[model samples]
Target: MPDTSSYLNSLPAIFSEDPFLGQFLLAFEQVLTGLDAAKDEPKQGLEQTIANLSKLFDPSAIDTLFTDDEKTLKAFLQWLSGWTALSLRADWDTGQQQRFLAEIVPLYQRRGTKENLAQLLKIYTGLLPIIEEAPDRPFQIGVNSTVSSTISADTAQIGGGTPHRFRITVTMKSSSTDELARQRQIIQAIVDLQKPAHTYYELPILIRTDTMQIGSRSTVGVNTLLGSIPTA
Candidate 1:
């Protein structure tokens, strides 16, 4: 009100008279100019921070991570490690890890049981396991067998280890040697993780060979590869 234009015009002279005041005014002017320019367009840093915060609050945004067909589930598993309370292995496939995470509550509920062990094996290997308890018998002579007879007790032992013994027989249709080797690695990994620390397991992978179809157009007989032919 008191000659505002003249007072404003006198500011430069007043600032110039005091060097510290001039530097302070110059910095304050720069700050005001920057804020004015910021008003013309959105601040990229602030907008990006807000966008990230919005994503964190949105459930659908998080769901997109688990719903993605490829890497999302794997990433979710890594995030859920603390919540799931499971020691996840890197060698396990993403699907296997996800299944483990999904069933972790139930598996922990039934931990150390035959059902839990079988479920764990199935989750990792996609094959049902046969759990046998006390599969080994002590070798001894039978009282019913005669001492002089040629047919003795027929002492033969198969699996002798801890009371817990699980056998997983995988019958694969793949004839590729590489496939078989890969399957063995998969089986070994599953066994190492799924089995109890003191338990022993037998993973016998059997390759299935189909018989040839004999027809009028092709009458050639299939030859066996691994054994000697019987002589009549």
Candidate 2:
């Protein structure tokens, strides 16, 4: 059993560097404080602990973590597995609960690559299985036209000279058949918006409807589309 006190020591190092995650860590601390107060049934207390941790990431939060440190994010998931066993003690098969708890506790002790990235991968697959090495993978932001062009009924204009529908195409690599069509749609949106340079745009707005696959089952999940519209 870890002293739990020792875990506090890692805080300064972790917090000093990552303010946003540090604030999240503070919230985690509050959950611990609550756990201490509910010392009656380790089971019930554990359930509360799990609930609090779940709050740390409300589904969508996983996307944010993947966008940052995926490895660390995966390592931290051991805590989630342990919390689950504790939370389901009464309802789950007693043997299964004990087995899961035994398996996951060690992970919290030594986070980072060594503990068991495989197990973590299995656990987080449902949450963010398709984490991209880069944001909007497959379709990365490539060299877009620095200049804009337009064509009117009478003549054509270049570089912001006139208002013409300029078609901008963002290519997404390794896209699945299902996503390839949608990727084109999203890129078209970028052309339609006529946005300026250096901004993040939520593309493929219709992409949420696509059914996501688990693990390496689907390669196309990571592609994304973006459009660059010059102000000039």
Best by TM-score: 1
TM-score of the candidate numbered 1? 0.44
Query: lDDT tens digits, residues 96-210, model 2?
Result: 4334455555654543331243343333221111211112112112433222222212222233232221222132334477766654543434223323333222222222223
TM-scores, one per candidate: 0.44, 0.21
| Candidate 2 TM-score, true structure as reference | 0.21
RMSD of every prediction: 15.0, 21.2
Model 1 lDDT tens row, 105-128: 667777767777777666655555
lDDT of 1: 0.51
Weakest lDDT window of 10 consecutive positions for candidate 2: 126-135
Please give the CA lDDT of all the candidate structures: 0.51, 0.36
